[model samples]
Target chain A: MPATLAEKILQQHCDEQITGPGQIVRCRLSLVLANDITAPLAIKSFKKMGAAGVFDKDKVTIVADHFTPNKDIESAEQVKVCREFAKEMGITHYFEGGNVGVEHALLPELGLVGPGDVVIGADSHTCTYGGLGAFATGMGSTDVAAGMALGETWFKVPPTIQVILTGELRQWVGAKDLMLALIGTIGVSGALYKALEFVGPLASTLSVEGRMTMSNMAIEAGGKVGLFAADDKTLAYAAAHGRKGDKAIAADAGAAYERVVTIDATGMEPQIACPHLPDNVKPVSAVAGLKVDQAVIGSCTNGRIEDLREAAAILKGRKVSKDVRTIILPATPNIWRQALAEGLIETFMDAGCIVGPATCGPCLGGHMGILAGGERAIATTNRNFKGRMGSLESEVYLSGPAAAAAAAIAGEIIDPAKV
Target chain B: MYHGTAHTVGAHIDTDAIIPARFLVTTDPAELGANCMEGLEAGWIKKVKNGDIMVAGENFGCGSSREHAPVALLGAGIPVVIAHSFARIFYRNGFNMGLVLLEIGDDVSKIHDGDELKVDADTGVINNVTTGQTIQCKPVPPFMKGILDKGGLIPYVQDRLAERA
Candidate 1:
C-alpha cells in the first residue's frame, strides 16, 4: 500500500525499519523538549543514566514558561533543576520565561520545529507542533531521559484519519470553535490514536495560529496528531519566524488515509465547550446571555500576541461589564512585553480588564486566577473538562480570545461580532 | 514480550485521569502504578487481570503526552492495548516504551471490560472466550513487530546498534 504523509515523514527520518501501528519501532528522535513541570524529573533521570553529555545538546529545547516567577518553593525548585541541568549538559537553547512562552508556542516561533521532524515535549499539548508539519507528540520523564541519553525514541506510525472541513465558518467562529465542534461530534475519543489530517477549503483559510489551536486540542479529542500539509501558510509562518530553508513539506496527493471525517462550517454558529469537557459543546446561541464572573484571555492556546491584539481591538475604550472581570495573560513574557509596547495593555486596562503575570496563571489553576465556587468564567485556555481550572462547582466556558473579550465586556455570553 | 486475553473500555481514557499530572515527577513506577486508575471508574483497576490486554473504543491516552501513562500500565503488567484508535503522542510514547497497541474494528464495544480475549498478533485473531467470538485485528507490520519483540525502544536500539557495531 502507498504510504501516507505520516508514513513518508517517518521513513525520511527513520534510521531503521518503520514500526507499523500496534508494533514498536526504535528510532532516533530529531528533537526533544521539556518544560518546568516535567524537567525536574527528566533531570533526575538523566543523572541516573550517567551519560557523558547529551547526544546533541543543541537539539534539546528547554523553556521555563509554566511557572515564570518561580512562584513557590516547588516551582522554583523545578526551574532551578532545569537551569542546572541545561548548564551542565551545555545545552545552549535555554529560554527563561521572559524570552519564553508555552513550549508549543515557542518551539515553532524559534524555528526549532519543521516538517517531518519527530519532536517530543514533557507536555500533552506538544502535539501542537504538528501544525508545523512535524510528527510531534508528548512524552514522560523516562522517555525524555532516554532521549536525553540516547537522543532517540521509539514510535508506531499510526493509521491516518482525514478530517475534511468543508464550507465556510459563520461569523465569530474561529479555529477553537472548529475543534470544539469536532470534539462534540467525535466524542473526545472519536479520533483516538489515529492521525487527523485536516483537508478541504476550510483548512486552507486557517492561519498557522488557527491550525496550531486546532492541533493543540487534538489531545482533548484523543487524536494522536492533528496535522495539515505544509502549505503556503506553513511556509509563510516559518519564513516570517526566520526559518530560512527546508521547513515546508507537502503530503503526497495519493497518501493513504484510514478514515475521512467531514465538517461543514457553513451555517455553523459560534460554539462553546462548557466547563469540564471539550466534548460537551453547544452552539453559542444556546448559552447566550448566560452571566459570567470572569474572563481569561491567554494560555498556550490563545495567549499569542495576535490573539491579544484581536481582543484588544474589540475592548478598546469600552468599560468591562460590571458583573465580569477580564484577565489577559500573554502566553510568554515576550508577547506580554510586545503587547505592552504597542499599548495593547493600556487598552485592556482602559477597558477595565485586570492584567496578570506572564505565567500559565488561571489556565493551569496553579495560581493568580482560580475561580471561586459557582463562579462562571469564559476562558481561552485549552481543556475545559470538569475541574480543569479550579473548583469543580465553578463553571468555565471556552472560546477564542475575541469571544472571551466580548463576553467580558457584555458580562454575558455575547457574540464578538455583536460588540 | 507477553500476551493474553483482552479487556475493553470506552473512549477517552485520558492521561490526567490515567495518571494525573501531579504524580509525574517521581521515578518510582511501582508507586505511580499503584494509583494508575485513581481517576478511572472507581474500582476499575482491580478488575484487570495480570497479562490481560486492554481494548478501548478510541483516543486512548488522549490528554497530556505523558510517558508515565504507558509506564503505569506496563508497571501494572498490561501486555497489549487494542483500540479503534490512539492519541498520537500516547501511541508513539507507548511503542517507544514497548507497549503493544492494536488498532482494530470499531465493533470493539461488543467486548466486555474483562472478556477473556486471546490475541495471536501474528495471526491477527482476537478470540473472546466468553462469547466464543473472534475479531480481526490488522496485523502489525514486520518493522514494528521487530521492535515489540525486542522489548521497546531501549533494548531494541541496544540490539540494533550492537549488531551494526
Candidate 2:
C-alpha cells in the first residue's frame, strides 16, 4: 500500500510491519517531552512504576516553560518536583529559566527533534513537530510515564486527510490566517482521530516557521497531527539549527487519502477566530473596529522570529492605542536575544508594548498578563477558548501577528492590509 | 457491568469546559474534581454522583491535553463517558486515568439526559434502562482492555515490568 508521509514515518517506528491505517502498532519513540505543568505528574507516575531508571535518559527532555519562574507557591512546588526528579534521574536535556521557552518552539530550535522521529509529549501541542515531518502526538502524563519506563508506546494508526494549498497568500496574510481559514472550513471536529497532510504549492512555499504555526494548531481542528513533507526547506531549517543527518520524508505518489480538500490562497485575507471556539473564523474585514482591551503577540503557535519580524514591521513607527495594553512574548530566549539584536524589542517598547520573558504566559492564563472581567484581547496564540487568557467572561480573538499588532495600534481588530 | 444515571451535554464540550485553566493549578485529582465542568455549566460537580455516567455529542473532551480533564471527571465519580466520538488525546488520557469512554456515533441521540444506562465493558453494549433501548458500541481493543483491567497504564506497565522481572 502506498503510504502517506505520516504513515510512512510510523511504519519505520512501528515494532510490527504495518503500512495502513487503524493497525495497532507499538512504536519506539525517539524523544519524550514533558513541561513543568505535566512533568511532575509524569514523574509521579514514573515513580509508581518502580522502574529502576528511565529507559534512556538522553531521549527524555524536561522543560519548565509553562508557569516558568513559578506563578505561586503551588506552582513553585510543582516545578520543584520536576527539578528534583531531573537532577536525581540525571536527565541530560533538562532546561529551566533563561534556557527555557515554549517546548514546541525550543525543542526544534535546539535540534532535539527531526524528520522520521516518533515523538510524544505530555503537552497537546506536541503535534507541532509534524511540521518537520515527524510523527508526534500528545499523551497523558501516565502514558508519557509508560513511554519513559518502556521507551515505547502503542498507537492505532489514523487515516489521512490531504489539505492541498494552492496559489500564494496576499500581502499581510500568512500561515496564521491560512490556518484559521482552514479550521473554520473544517469545523473543530472535522478531522477527529485523523492525520492532516498539508501539500501543494502554497504549503511547499511556506517557511519552516510558517509550517510550524500551521502544524501547531492541528489540535484546534481535532487532528491527531498536521504534517508537512520534508523538503529542502525542512532540511535547511534542521541544518541551520545544528541538526545533522536530515532525511527526506514524503508521501508516496499514490498514497490513499480518506478525503482531500484544496484551499486556494490567492488573495486570501487575514483571518481571525472569534472568542469561545477556534473554528469561529472570520476575515478581519468582518470583525474590524471591535474594541479590544489588550493585544498579545506570542505563543507556541506564532512566537517564532518570523512572527516577531512581521509584527515589528507593522509597529515600527506607530504607537499602541492608549486605550489598549499590548504584551509581546518571544517564544524562546534565543528568539528574544535575536529580537533584541534586531532592535525589534526597542521598536515594540517605543510602540508602548510591554515585552516579557519567553514563556507561555497569558496564553494559558498562567501569568504575566491576565484579562479582567468583560475584557477583550487579540492574540497570536493557537487557542482562544473562553477564559484562555484570563477571566472566564473575558474574550480572546485569535489572529496572526500582523493583525494582532494592528489591533494593538487601533485598540480594535483591523485588516492589516488596510493599515 | 455498571449501571448509572446519565448527565448529558452537547457537542465539542472541550477540556477547558471540563476543568477550566484557572483550576489546573493542582495535580490532585480530588481538588480538580471539585471544580470540573464549572466553566460550562456551573455547579455541575455537585450534580455528578458516584457511578453516574456522562453522555455527550461528538468530540467530547476536545481542546487542551490536560490529563486533569479525565482525572477530574473520574474523581467526580463519572465511571464512563459515552459520546459520538472523542478527541484523540482525551480518549487516551481517559483510559490512562481509568475512565471508560464509548463512541456510539449516531446512536448517541437515543440516550437522553437522566436516562438510566447499564454499560457492559466486555460486550460493548449500552442499555438505556430509562427508555429500554440498546445501542452497540465498538469493543475495547485487547491491549487497551488490559490497561483498563489493571486500572490504567501506570499499573499496567508496573505489572508488565514485574512479570518480566
Top model number, DockQ: 2
The reply for model 1, stretches above 4 Å from the true place, is A1-3, A15-28, A47-50, B1-11, B22-60, B69-165
DockQ of 1: 0.30
Clashes of 2: 0
- Chain A TM-score vs. truth, each candidate: 0.95, 0.99
Instruction: List model 2 lDDT by residue over A221-272, tens digit each.
Output: 9998999999999999999999999899899999999999888888788999
Worst 10 residues of 1 chain B by lDDT: B156-165
Q: What level of docking quality does candidate 2 show? A: medium
Per-model lDDT:
0.76, 0.90
Instruction: Assess candidate 2 and give its lDDT.
Output: 0.90
Model 1 alpha-carbon miss at residue A219, Å: 2.4
| Residues A280-397, model 1: lDDT tens digits | 8898888889999999998878888888888998898898998887888877666878899999999998998889877665776566677777999899988774445666467889
- Model 1 misses residue A356 by how many Å? 2.6
Model 2 chain A poorest ten-residue lDDT run: A14-23
